[model samples]
Target: MHPMLNIAVRAARAAGNLIARNIGQQDTFEVATKNKDDLVTSIDKQCEKVIVDTLLKSFRDHGIIAEEGGVQGNPDSEYQWIIDPIDGTTNFVQGIPHCAVSIALRHNGKTEIGVVFDPMANEMFTAARGSGAFLNGRRIRVGSRDSLDGAIIGTAFPTRYRDRMHAYLELFSRLISNCADVRRMGAASLDLCYVACGRFDGYLEQGLKAWDFSAGDLILREAGGIVTDFMGEPNYVKSGNVVSGNPKVLRALLQVCDVQNLPAILK
Candidate 1:
């Protein structure tokens, strides 16, 4: 592992273990509504603190943009850690065993390393730019399905959006007609990781923050997958709206879903 990723892997595993222990242990676990569709728990905040404290302790000059906790340290630092301490909170709260700790390092505005650790399955997905992608230290790649006609795809609900529910439904229906299957698994980070590992041929989502995608996008790109926006541009890192898949299916799926006029915000 690269030195930066080595640190991320260590931090993610430590935080994931702490989170897994607290999962489903108490119905009285405190919860707060970030919004009607979004929820946050004490575990999320605590896990994020553990990760932030660990990373910042050694690299005090490094910047951090994270879920649960906001930005800290130097924003213009060459090394920035983007973190989702525990993604799949809905699954975690429900005791579904699909959540994980996701962390990444960005240097000069491009990803340098990424780590997503799923404690329940003991699976660790890691990637460093130009080094290829990995699961538990072994190589991994995107699926080889050539056609969307029989390929399984994934989607996520943008809990932050209120005006686009019906729009999403319409698009979902159109995709259902063309694709073999679609799944909405409620865990944005893990859903994208699954795409990176070839469990899903493609994944699309909107209204995501950097913490939700920074690690996943790096993993998917390193895993031989192509990721872009509906415009088919490499806008995944900038726009938050993302579409990813193996090359063949990525092209096919974009043809039906690309809304060039929707503006970058709606991408």
Candidate 2:
């Protein structure tokens, strides 16, 4: 393992444990609404602080872009650490056990290290650029399912776009008719990691932040999954619109949902 990735794995695992220990008990800690659909607990803030503090102490010069703490560390540096202490806040608050703590380190604009740890399942998915992906020290890969008809797909709800919900519903309807099944897992990072491990064959979403998918997408790609914008363009890294699965299934998805001006999940 690369030295930095080892550090990220440890940091993410530590944060995951911190979050897991405080799950259902969070209702009494304190809750804040980032929006109607988005919720954050006092634990979330604490977890981010722990994650950021640990990383900065080790690599004090690397920049950090996080969900709760915003940006911290040296912004002028070439390296960046992206952190999402709790990816599925609602799930965690409701004791659903589907959220995760994700961390990604970018070097010169390319994500070089990624970690997504689900303490509930003890599944730690890690990846390094060009090195491939792993879960619990074992290699993992995207599903080889050739077509959407046999694919188990996943999606997420828009956080603040009720008016766009109908568009989301229509897309879900189309995918449901052709795919073997559709799941809305609430945690985008976990959903993408599941796709990498073949738990789900593919995943799409509408409206996501950089911290939400940056690490997960790189992990998926390193796991041999293909990632792209819904329109079939290679726009995922910056646009935030991401479609991921095996190459065959990804291209097939592009043919189906690659509509012009369609609402992109990551955008």
Candidate 3:
């Protein structure tokens, strides 16, 4: 295993364990509403602390950009750790058992290590720059499904940005018309990893944060999948509007998005 990736796995697993222990115990912690729909529990902070502390222990100079906790460490540092301590906070708080611990290491602004651990399932999805993606200790790859017909796609609605919901529904309608079906699972990190391991043929979403997709982005690419913005560009990380799948499926999805004449704001 890559050294940095090893640390990432450790951090993710530690946070995952913390999350697992506290699942369904919402009464034990406080929940804060970040917005009309987003919820952050005190466990999120505790998990973030565990992950950040674990990482900083090995690389004290590395910077951090997290969900509950904002940017920390020196902004000028070449190495940055992006994290979503609880990728499915709502699910976790509701005892849905679908959340994950996401951690990624970016060197000079390029993500080189990714780890998304589902504590409930004890599944660890990991990847390094050149190494292939993995679940547990075995390598994994994206599904070979090349077409949208009969494809099982995953997605999350832009609930936080309701202004884009209309365009989102349009895209969803078009996709369902040609594909098998669509799933709106709440966890973006696991949704991307599902695509990486063939459980989901593809996925799309908007208004996500860097912490949400940074780790899964690297994992999917390492597993032979592709990710891009709605415009089929490399700006998904910046735009937070991502479409991902194996090569052929990705092109097909882009085609569906193209005809929508989606508002420029979405791209």
Candidate 4:
């Protein structure tokens, strides 16, 4: 593993273990609402602190962008660690056993390493820029589904941006009509990792944060998948709306989004 990637994996595993131990022990933790319906838990804060501390211990000059803690460390540093300590806080809070700890390292605005660790499942998805993606130390790849037909795609609802719900439903309806099935798994990081490991053929969702998909995006790309915004631009990080799959399935998904004529906010 690349040296930086090794550090990322270590940090992610630490946070993941913290999350796993807290499952079904919600009474021991506290929960709060942020951005209306979005949830954050005390466990989330604890995990973020663990991850940020670990990363900074190794590279204190690097910057940090965390979901709960916001930006920290040297703001002008060329290296930044993007973190979502618990990608499925709701699932973790409810004892659903489906949350993950996501960490990514970016150098000069380009992602160099990604790690998404599901402590409940003990699954570690990892990737370095040029290295292939891996799940539990084994190489992983996207499914070879040629198109949307008969493909099992994954997604998450636009719970944060309710105004875009109608547009999402239209896309969902079109997708369900053509695919084998669709799943709303509640965690965007795991949804993308599922795509990387061929558990799902494609994945899409709107109203996500950089910390939500940054790691998973690198994993999927390293696993031979393509990701873009609804407009077919490599701007999902800025738009917070993402569509990803193997190349053919991705093109098909873009067509469905185009047909919907989604509002400007979603694009």
Which segments of model 4 are wrong by more than 4 Å?
264-267
Candidate 4 residue 21 Cα shift, in angstroms, is: 1.0
Model 1: what TM-score? 0.94
RMSD of each: 1.8, 1.6, 1.2, 1.2
Number of clashing pairs per prediction, in order: 0, 4, 0, 0
Q: Considering only N, C-alpha and C atoms within 3 Å, which residue pairs clash in candidate 1?
A: none
Order of candidates by lDDT, top first?
Answer: 3, 4, 2, 1
For 1-267, candidate 4 gives per-residue lDDT tens digits of 898989988998898888988986878999889978789988899999999999999998999999999999998999999999999888898899898999998999999899999999999999999999999999999999998889998987777777877877877888899899999888899999999999999998887889999999999999999999888899888978899999999999888777447673464
Instruction: Please give, for residues 1-267, the per-residue lDDT of candidate 1 as tens digits.
Output: 687788888899889987779887657477777878677888888888889888988899999998877888888899999999888887778788888898989999888898989999999999999999999988999999988988889897666785777777767777899999999887777777898889999999887888888898889889999888766888766777788899998998787674753443373
State the weakest 10-residue window (summed lDDT) of model 3: 258-267
Which segments of model 1 are wrong by more than 4 Å? 260-267
**Candidate 4 similarity to native, TM-score:** 0.97
The local distance difference test score of model 4 is: 0.90
In angstroms, what RMSD does candidate 2 have relative to the true structure? 1.6
**lDDT per residue as tens, model 2, 42-81:** 9889889889988998999999999988889999899999
Error of 4 at 71 (Å): 0.8
Considering only N, C-alpha and C atoms within 3 Å, which residue pairs clash in candidate 2? 205-265, 206-265, 207-265, 240-266
